[model samples]
Target chain A: MMDPLLHVKNLKKYFPLRKGFLEKEKTYVRAVDDVSFSIRRGNSFGLVGESGSGKTTVARAILRLIEPTEGEVRFEGMDICRSSESEINEMRREMQIIFQDPHSSLNPRKTVFKIVSEPLIIHEGLRGKKLRRRVEELLETVGLKSEHMFRYPHELSGGQKQRVGIARALSLNPKLLILDEPTSALDVSVQAQMLNFLESLQRELDLTYLFISHNLAVIRYTCDTVGVMYLGKIIEMGEAEKVFSMPRHPYTKALVSAVPIPQAEQPETAILLEGDIPSATHIPSGCRFHTRCFEKIGAVCEEREPETYCFPDGSQVNCHLFKSTALDDEAGHGGGSGKPLETKDR
Target chain B: MKPVLEITDLKIEFDTFEGTSHVLDGIHLSLGKKDTLGLVGETGCGKSITAKAILRLLPVPPARLVSGEILFGGEDLLKKSDEEMKEIRGRQIAMVFQDPMTFLNPVFSIEEQLVDVISAHSNRNGSRKEIDRKEAKKKAVALLGEVKIPQPDVRIKSYPHEFSGGMRQRVLIAMALSRSPQVLIADEPTTALDVTIQAQILKLLHELVERHGNSVLLISHDLGVVAKVCRRIAVMYAGSIVENCSTEALFNEPFHPYTQGLLNSILTFSKRKDAAQGIQGGIPDLIHPPSGCRFHPRCSRAMKICEIEKPSPVEAEKNHVVSCHLYPVRKVKSF
Candidate 1:
């Protein structure tokens, strides 16, 4: 088997909450807790969940943009989570991120040429005409014309701003790019154009992507493997087809079924979860998704936290349903290497 | 079903610094008594403008209605005076906007806002004094419960900031239906909401419309969202109503080139044919759209006629009407 490029093991990020000024009763938000996954070389691994499901937190933790409270982020076999400042700075050159809101991420005052060329100037120390040529080439590569290189972020449309954002991300020629809801802001027509461009760019540049999105359709189109985050925890992770078509965790199934299918009658298998997502500050005791799980059992699911059950394919599901299957086959091959005890934080 | 609201040849323009931008180019649409009519389009396609025009909510200096008549209950709403329009705004028709956060007042409690909405419609016949504070609060509680907001009694005291996006939208829905208006204009009501919350809100709207016998003018950019509740659908492109038909006909057999492009653009869970190809190019600049057909610039099957002259409405099917040169209306047989 080929080596994984990005191995995220048991990543956790907790934000402290202080209610009162006097007593200082502190509680943890548990933004991203116990998320473990590995991206094989040149493959796009997607993280999908609702707004407060902690998808963005996992992405930030992997990039070390926001330092994780616990666990290891091994990039190209080096543990970047605990790396030295200089070592982490070196890793930053290889990994770049394109934020979700282009309107916010890109500097409003910076011109397109300046925005795209700043990375080259800082990283490779290119200046003057050399920097200008590289910036033009980058813009042309992302389907933007050379004329747009002088315009500010505000002057461009939503789609154009996103293209500028892509051009700036690609300027560094990074091996890995984290695209966080890249097309959620654009219209359907513009979103399609952006998505096709991303796919072509991936093949052209041989880039690995950590795609984070809530839209299931976009995730299905872009990702090779998918990780379903629920309330700061990765409830399910597997190949995109396996997870989307036949999701092991109930939360994952509900999410897949929620996306509306076009040119078809109402989906027969629509799993509409009844309640609103609980606040992340006060997460549920046992299973984060047990409150909304369609296939939830009474006692076991609501009591103990489910352990990660690994399949032969290295995909993991944190649910008692798969856990029981493992217990049933405990005698065979000594659990058949289906338990992620080595990587399990719990 | 009796036609409750009708918009005929509705043309509007915005006076920007650059020039006069023609926003809605002769939009023709109608809503039945108890049907959901979805005005679906992409951004900058004049879907929201059409909704705001229906309620006469567009600012006067900026937005000018050049040639159009919004007929509600057989009377032209365009001719209504300011006082008369105010009377008709909340009593006859109510609107639920896109962003629930901004649509609702932050400082006002749920009870205060709902009661204010109830009391503001003072021209509703002799029922003005009948709805006192206590009675209005009771009705607000009942309305909140109808929209499926939990603990209505206690939550009514909480401000809008205390509610989630879904819950805030539900509160807006409750207020929109407070007077039980005949027509409800929901302008992308669930666009800001999550998918799970979106489903719940759509379900709530469906149930409310079913029970109350009201009409919904659902303006949304998403095709699947309006398909969930809308009986009749209209696909708009660059201010023109490209296709209008029953939901089944629109989904099963789309006619216009732009409509076809839109249907193709929807990213399905199943495999995409070839690479995913969307309608090429951004929406046309409304100030000076394409010479003939608005969508001709990006259309795959665009012809010389599509560039030269705009196609009129063609009744391709029993109730389906499309505006395109490709499918000419067949001659009616009288054998």
Candidate 2:
């Protein structure tokens, strides 16, 4: 709306593969290829995909944890990718990340106080009483008792440890937070608590989040906007409600269908995608989802790559069925299956 | 129909340096022959402990079942001696753990592992002294086939690491079935697997249990997995069965706040368009859990009565049992 707080344009991250004798550079694994999305200030934008979908790569690239092969990352209208070292350091103070694994993300040897205060010490140059007070305040904000500040990571439960992670992220008082599957490891009850805490924290702190998770349910609930990534590309992107209710992309539909309903009698037949997710190194030509595409739209889906078809409602899908050309051609002659391709086959 | 397994008021405690951590607090469960009971809970809820306690496999000294009756076919397993329990472990109740790699030996071939399991069970039953190695190998291959492992014959000779994570889990399931135990305990069997692989394994397990007419205890953090495989669901909290009901009932009108919270937290594709509502507050410290209701600290509708007194098991409806003070129909019990 007002030039999104963070603008990611054509982000691409490729990991080089080395092979044989002299260790010649082999082919590069295009982890995050031509991915672009922006997050509004204080709004949560979710990135959903399976393990190798490059959702994590996009998060890391935006955080500058892993340098992108090519693209532009603008944070608060400042181009982070091209920023000088001093400028980048200055920008780092306003952005932070909370990793998936709480146990590993935290230093096992360090106490909770040290862990949370580490950020403040490095960025704000506060120590001793001031740092301890700040750390306690952060812990209190995350729903942890002030006394828990002295405990080590191992002493705390999975949920408590995640709280410590959250506290550390907030210690820097950052505007943007990148949460990478923050609740995947916790228990359902605990996961619920964490999600609630995150929502409340976002509200109170007015934080912007680039939430990355394989869990569609969490994303559906927490994010204001949603982006579904397949392989290295964003196949679908739109408002959270629009994307969830009316998913246009076949991959998105399959993903949505895959979520398990607690009480309702699921259809005897699930939209079971055959085979494992293909290796990214050897991506199929054309539509990345062609191999598992249940629609089986035939050769066109596997021959020419589809472009993102933007809808008036702000929803976008990169599928052949929605291509403006196809729609226009069909409308002009009233040929082919003039019907808007049924999203759900069954 | 007689239940294949019944556990009554089971309590497990771990002796740690800090103190005796009361892990499993009076957990009671029952499963009819060929029934699938889904044990759903978050991490450290003691869902896995319930399974381990059934097999008497918990590490002693630090781990001890204070009181409970694990009755399999009317036999009180807790009262049974260590030697007696060993006989029941694989022969009557078999288990498939979460991680296949950790459960499987890397050095040994798949065939060797499966054969060893069969041999061990057979030896316990006093089947034969001179075990036929070749015949055992054939049986192992067949077991592999039963679990739907592709290229079973060739794959049987490969080491555990050679197989993918899903395939290895399938191998473990096959090994558990070799004993043909009346009850199968699978603890987060598909957590490490992909969704497609997880679906396949769930289907395979469902078919195996139905065809064999054996009961299964499916333990997992995922309610979706439970919804697919289990006929009945047991919602555990802080080592206690907070809610137990038929799958349909649990999903339709969950009486327990914890169960409702859990169900709401799980996001399904059908409801992907809707926002997910997660439960508030973290789990209480088990060692020093809340005085009354373990879940009271996080319960949205927690009352002063809930904090002061524990609620007894109330028959909320037909086949639905809940432990919460909110339901006026239920009486509060003192801890």
Candidate 3:
């Protein structure tokens, strides 16, 4: 499929907890454990999960903003994890990240002009008037006026500040933009404007987006492919429409049902999970979602993790309930161009 | 339906150094008994201020209540003395704040926090001798259990830091409902929580409010959240309620231009043809809002009269009311 823009294979990021005095055993919080996904060119891939589900960690690991413990992050056929420092720095020009909070992401001290111009100056070595013109162009591209360039971060409103952040992210002319909860901080009306602007920008620039948000409705609106993360593991992945409409995995079902729609009439029943997400440090055995899974079946779920089961419509779910589907697909294809039976980990 | 809590001609101005900010401009709201009414608005729309004004919680010099009557249970809450308000605050009109972590004391155990609320109520009522520590502790556990916090007995001893955000919110709910208040004001209660957790909290709130038969004033920026828990919604813009109607009517046939814009701006899961265009321009500066109608500058359907004269509330339907020139009150025709 035109060599996916970004291919992340088994990306794992673990942060080690401080060791106690006279302790021999070392423990680590597996924030992003064995997460693998590929984003096709010009497509938006949404990563959705509750807090501490490692969605942000996966984004950081791919960009090498935070180093991955193990995995191959192939961006345009270049291994980011294995690339040298200089090579990675050069690659940074192609991939940019838009942080969640514009309030904290933008430096309060710097004017909008400086914030937008810094990347251009650092990368292209443009000078004086040229840089000013470029910064103004970027600001205008993000729907802000040239007049806004002189204003500090605090001087601008929430929507304006976010536009500046977007303008900064676009300054490098990056092919891929990892937007982490871009609209969560915005007001509803402003969020709508931003979403529409982003969609138009994507079409105009031919950019690939790795959009991470906890808001299902926003994700559904912005993304093409959706991945549901639970305690550092992607339990389900498929087309956004399919995944949201007919969610297979129990976690996905619960999550889809959990989203409160704007309509007055609610669904008859929602599968309410019992407790909060388990700690990343102490992930539950077998299926990571077993602790709170509503549709869990017997000992298999508690004993062993399910293999990735592929459907005819290109959706993949990791749950034992779909075990027979994978077997049938393998049987029909005779192990030739079949979708499901790739288990290198086993 | 007789309104248990009524706010009429409410006008509040914040006298800041940067000129007088007319925060709340002639707001009118009514909460009937056992009503679950939502106050939905964008940030700086004075939703919180209105709630604060009801409790006389706004600091006076900076925030001057220019004119208003907050009638709670046939009495003017605005005119109530501090002591009288204190008696009514927790026992009658309870509040659940947005951020539970900050509202809850970190050092105290959940049990201690819950017991303190109970004891405070008793001490204020001049019945301090009736309820002891043991009785309060038992009631605290029961309250925690009622909010669906797992293992209330054991969890009650744990500190605020030990509980998750959802659990902490549950504790706050328990504290708010401890004395069984007549009215509960939840100001963006689930805004800080995750979607799943928010669902749980909303469901709990819906169930509890239904069970207790307490009138609730749910203030939130999210229409979806308001839709889930509230039967009636009051859409606030700038410093005024532009529209107030039944949840169904507001969603299906919104009368006000700003209300229509706000609804159109939200991205719903259900597929639709047109993209949300959103409202143009930011919220108006309250200090020098607009010439007349506060929303006129941004309203697409703004008429010339909208700039010259402030529109008064017009009954669009039996219960639905909107403050807009589009739906001007029709003159009664003589037979």
Candidate 4:
């Protein structure tokens, strides 16, 4: 197998929660705590989680839009997290992000040409007719005509605006693109077009993508590898098809069941998790998902968090059920708990 | 089965500075009692406009219902006077918008908002002596409880901003259901929410409508959301019902090219990870729409007939209807 294009090891980002008269530091909101994964060259890695699940934070951390507090991020064997100021600036040319909200991402004052050409001006030092031609070429590549160059962001529809955003990201000729919920804000019909464009662009440009979305359907369709996160931890990661088809973690199963199958006559009885997601500042003891988990084991689950266990097929799951079986054999208990363990957290 | 709300040949136009935007043209939908009808369309496809037209809630100067009748309980809602419509608005037909913050008053407490909505259509007359504010407050709390808001007693006293985005939406839903309207119009109800919250809210709406024996007209841009809640669906394009069929039929065998493109676009995580395809090109300008079929410019299977002629709705089966030239053989025989 070829070497992975990007490797992330124990990536952690914690936002400070400040309060009081002096605005003293309180607790930290563990946004993207200890997430680790890699994306192969020309392949897409999808990060799936509900809102506040740190999927966006993970994407932002990869782009270095915000710095990571701990861990390593290697792009093509070079540690981007450890790079100097000048080195990081040059490295940005190879990594770019497409924001979820197209309207807010683009500068309202700038024309389409200026928005698309800005990256080239700063990074490549191209100017005059040469740059203008490149801008038009990029726009055309994304399906926009030359006439759209003069128009501002407000003139375009949601789908067109998104295409312009895509055009801007492609302007830099980045090796990897971080798409943060790119199509969640788009209409279903327009979303399809964007997805197809992304796929084709990947083939033509040999681009790698780190796609972040809460939509399971979108993630399933676009990603080669899928990571399911909850409370800043990746509970499951594996081949997109295998993980989705046979989700090892109960949370992954619940999330997959949540998505409405387009035409299936009998909708599956969703593994509905009762109660709202707990506050990140005050995370539950032991497993982060134990409060909502249906197959939680007894005191062991509440006392000790589960670690990732790799399967023969390269699938990895961070769940007590998978861990407890291993522990039972080690302890010579002969795999007989007899019944499903009821956790104290529940 | 007679439909509780029937909109026939509905046409709406917005007079903007640019030109007259033919927003909704020849829209026809029928919502039967206790049945859920999904109004699926892209942004600016007039799904919201159609919903506003039903309650006569379209902003006056810019929006005008050019022609057609919106019949509710055998009466034309389009012809209803402002006073008559006010009586029917919350009592017979209530609507929950996408953003609860925009619809909810920031300064007002949840209790005040819920009570105001209940009293607006309540039969209790202007006798202050007979009307109990405490009773109304209790009813408000109960309504909140029905929507599954925890600690409804305490939460009702808090302002809209105090609640999370999902909780505020629940509060809005509670207010809409306070009067126990026969029909509820949810326009992108879960668009702004997270997936888990969206799932919870969708489930709640489905349960509430069933328990109350009320019908729902769910308008959403996401087909996934619609498939989860609605039994039947109406696919709208360029302000007209392009296809109407059961959710099962629409997903399994979509007759219209637009519907097929929409289904193919949705990325199902359990399926293959090939990038979902999107319909090429943007929706045409409503003011200067295409001469015949609005989707002709982007459609891959466009025919010569689609260029110059509009297709009328042809009944494909007992209740299924589609408006497209491609279904010519079925149209000629059915029509």
Candidate 5:
């Protein structure tokens, strides 16, 4: 198969902590460590993780919003990560981002017209009547009218403000859109509207999306391929349906099972992780999920990080249960009580 | 079975500079003794306002009670004096807000706050038990332990910021349970926590309610969260209760269009193939709300009568009720 629209290879981002007055050594917050994924043309690739899991960091790193420590972000065959200044500036035209909170992300003082047209003016140098027409057209595409272009950001409702944000993101007619918790701040009904609009927009524009959200249902609905992150690592990645329906990793199963169904009763069996996610500043040595993973393999998961295990169905999981290799029984990787963990605990 | 709390024809209005915002348009609900009722809705939908009205937490100057009575265990809370309401606030009807940080005093330790609440209720009105700080401390530690807070004895001395978001919410729950109040109103208790921690907190609430036999008014936007803890759910849309029914009936056969819209918006694992759809229009402005049914503008099956006449609650099915013009045959004549 040909390479996907976007290929992110082993991206790493480490934020160095300020050294204390007396201490000589400094610590680093490994925000996004050794993460890799790809989004096919016009397909949304979701990145799901709890807060501090570094999903957002990966998105930012790919866009070069922050200087990534290492790795390559190849966008449409161009290595944006290592590209020259002029090339990156040109690359920015084909890529844009929509933030989670439109209220904060948008300038309160700027009218909807200015907010949406600013991107177009910066990139294409459209002016006056042309710019206004473009802004109105963009607004119309997002289901807003020309009349709304004059209103300030604060005047618009939460949902309407998000529409303006979308219009602005689409001003440049970008091929790839990085949506960071795009619908999280909106209400339930409003979220539905935005999600539908996003779906329609994707189909019409033939855009690729890197949808990042902690909400599993949103990801399940919007994303085609999914990557589940745990402590700055993509522990699982596969087709959205398979990963959600048949999660292999313990953390993935717990996340998948923990999603509340709007039914009367919960499922009988649930893989409830033991504690809160550990702080990212001091990530666990091997398999950061071991601290909370209820199905942890005796001592192997704690000491050695499991290598990526590829299944027959094109799914990848970083878990010991699916550790497909010659293993000596004495090493504890092949514990006698091994259940070959899937969704259920033995 | 008698209701632990009953709210009848409860209407609330907020006087803003633009106009009078009709926040709660005649909310009617009853919590049976030892029952958990979930009041679910989107933001600014009056679910939170209803919760505030129950405790008289809304500021009187800005918020006016247009009409209706809040009856608590056979007595009208609206009629109670300020002094009497004070006694009832913490001891009779305890409340846990959404954010634990804002509700909890950051300056004080958990022990101090928990002990204060315990002692405040124990000594309120006319209780024979003498107020003892030591006993309160002991009870506070026990309450913390009941909520599954680790090292309760040591953790009790820590400040609120020291605990994680989930743990702080558990602390708030512990404080609410500390008084052994007859009614516990948890308003979006787990909204601030992650899905995993939300599960843990939800389990804690269910267990506490079971053990204490306290009626709960669980208000949340997430339908799943409400469904897990509540047996019956009241779906509010634009300051009005559009559907109130058993959790099973609401899930299986939602009568109201708004309720159906909410259910469809959620993409459940089991229903992956079903496409998600939202109500077309935004909520009507409360300042100038629609004449008859607030949801009429967005309803797919809306008729001319829906625009002219407000829908009365109709018995659509067994243990299921809806306020929509679609079910005119089952519409009851009761106010």
Candidate 6:
């Protein structure tokens, strides 16, 4: 009911494969092609995909880190893609990103104090005493000691470095945070700690999260809404519980089944997908997932692209199998058999 | 079941600039013939070091094998001569490294690399008849085909750079299996691959190990992956194997606190009611690790004696051993 904190509509980012200077024909890697999702004020929306599925590109495009090729990204009704540099800079105070790799993201030369206070200094222009106090407070908030403020990035462990990264992201008190594989670089125990910490932080700060990760279990644990991306397209988007429990799309089913569950004497029913994901530059025709889709129904899946079908449970799936049921009812916001109200069909 | 490879009290120390890092402190592991045993641990837990020590791959000057015996085929591998070990390296115990790209030579074609592995393995010892290039190439193609690489004849000619990450891993597997080693040590073989690719690789590895009838020591950080393929699981904490048990027993009821914590930490697909839980602290610095039990510092059920004395391995159940003070020693064993 409260307008979604961050709304991305039909976002696209294409990286061109440059050949010669004189070459007229250009080929593009469709990284984030026609992705649309909305995150509520305090809810976490997870974008789950594999290596080249373009989940990171979506996050980058939303932040205008890499300019989107087309479509609207409305952050609290403000057009982010079309905003001026100064306007975007002002908007950045409310939105922040926690990068995937803590080892490379932080400046090696900068101490924990400098890294955490950079945003505060740049935005609010807080002076020496005020800045030191704020940095110490931020470090303490992320479970680091005041003594850790003087330590360099190299001196910190992987888990400690990640804590500092979190501390830095929380420094600005941003309303929306885009976490791109925040715990993938960490060990399992450390990853759990980070996940719980992020959850607690969200509840305490009422922060909107765009959580991007390839780890399905992490997504299922942390996110309220989930989007399953294949190649570049989001084939499935729904409540995390619904999508994970009863995955509609064939790719979603395979992706879910592929994850090795740590259970005792479980059935070896994991759908081992044949071959690797097709290159984004040469994305498959029609349904991008058709090459490896197990439940693919012949010609239609190969010739024509599928439309987003909204179900009664407010879940949306883009697949030919759900076509018959989708056409029976009218289009609506949440409960409908037809196309979803948020995303376009074309 | 007799062990194909048995390591008892294997202690290894690395002489670094800072100090002597006790990387593998009295590690005990046994891989039975035609069995899959997974060594699961965190980054600095010395899983790789243990694997390297089994093959005697660690540099001598910096790496001092403090005390232990690596028994392979009823002989101590540590006492074996350098030339003798070289012969056994690939022919007896082959290893599949984590990154395929780094392990594979960029300049050579897949055919050349496969041929090199095949010929080098066959032409060792000098007493046997030399294997020709033509015979090696033919065998290489068959090996590739065995790993399910489509149209192996043509693809074998393609360079490593041309192949995808998963395909490169398959090539690595093929190379490791070329010699038909008695033992296969895959150190995080599928860690570099995507989830789907990882699944495929895991399945392929399971099938290959079954077909070849070779023991496998799989080193990985993912419990899910180990649970999927391995029959037995070993949980290592800070250079020491804290728990060793059957996969079913581990999943059903883990004895060691570290093993329980590790299992609880893994985020499973099935929705959990409680919030994600983690161990209290990170893995300790191995250079000056915690005395007695390295995990005692971060352990939830740590007692006063855990700080001073190292608890010996106890047989909690049949084929289930745990090194923790909480579980009193019922039956003491060498490992």
**Among these predicted structures, which one has the highest DockQ?**
6
**lDDT, residue B245, candidate 3:** 95
Question: In candidate 4, how many Å is residue A207 off?
Answer: 2.1
Candidates 1 onward: DockQ, in order: 0.58, 0.41, 0.69, 0.58, 0.66, 0.76
Write the residue-wise lDDT of candidate 1 on B223-303 in tens digits. Answer: 888888888899999998999998888888888888877887777677552356777788888988898888888988989
Candidate 1 docks with a DockQ of: 0.58
TM-score of candidate 6 relative to the true fold? 0.97
TM-score of each prediction: 0.95, 0.87, 0.96, 0.91, 0.94, 0.97
Q: What's the distance in Å from true for residue A233, model 2?
A: 2.9
Where does model 5 sit among the CAPRI classes? medium
lDDT by residue (B154-254, candidate 6, tens digit) is 99999999899999999999999998899999999989999899989999999999999989999999988999999999999888888999999999999
lDDT of 5 by residue, B50-95 (tens): 9888998889979999899988978999988888889888788999
Over the stretch A1-346, how does candidate 4's per-residue lDDT look in tens digits? 6667788888999998777668765789998878888788988889999888899988778778899999888898899888888998888889988999998998999999989998899888998999999999999899899999999999998888989999998988899999999987887767877887788899999999999988887788788888899999888888888888898899898887777666647466887766677777877888888888888878877877777665545666778788655454444322322111111111
Interface C-alpha root-mean-square deviation, candidates in order: 1.8, 2.9, 1.5, 2.1, 1.6, 1.3
Compose the digit string of candidate 6's lDDT tens values, residues A158-243: 98899899899888889999999999999998899889888988999889999999999999999988999998888899889889
Better of 1 and 6 by TM-score: 6
Candidate 3: stretches off by over 4 Å: A329-346, B330-335
Model 2, range A1-346, lDDT digits (tens) per residue? Answer: 3667888888899998876669665888989988877787888999999888898888888878788899989998998888887888888879988999998999999999888888788889997888878887888999899889899999898888999999988887899999999989887656766887798889999999999998887888788888999899888888888897888888888777666666647667566666567778878888888988888678998987777665645556788877655456445422223122112111
Backbone clashes, each candidate: 0, 2, 0, 4, 0, 0
Candidates' lDDT values, in order?
A: 0.84, 0.83, 0.89, 0.84, 0.86, 0.89
- Which segments of model 6 are wrong by more than 4 Å? A329-346, B125-127, B331-335
- For candidate 5, lDDT tens digit of each residue in A1-346? 5457888877899999978788878899999988877777888899999988999999888889899999888998999888988998898888889999999999988999889888888889999999988888899999998899899998888999989999999999899999999999998888877988899899999999999999998898888889999999988888899999998889999998888888876686866777788887889977788888888777888888877665545567788877644134223323322121221111
lDDT string for model 1 (A1-346, tens) is: 6668888877889998877888667898989888778887688888999899899988888778898999988899999988988998889888989999999999988999889998888889998888899998999999889999999998788888998888888887888999999999888877877888899899999999999999988888888888888888888887787788788788877777776555536655667888889998888877778888778887888888887777655457888888657546543422423233322221
Better lDDT candidate (5, 6):
6
Worst 10 residues of 2 chain B by lDDT: B267-276
RMSD of each: 2.6, 5.1, 2.6, 4.8, 4.3, 2.4
Per-residue CA lDDT of model 2 for B1-335, tens digit only, reads 87878998888899888888889888889999888999998878899889988888888978987888989888898889998888888778999999999999999999888889887777666645755778888899999889888778998999998787878999989988887889999999999876656777888898999899889999988888898889999999988899988989888988898887877776655444234566776676677878788889888889999888877677777678888887757443533
Q: What TM-score number comes out for model 4?
A: 0.91
Clashing pairs in 3: none
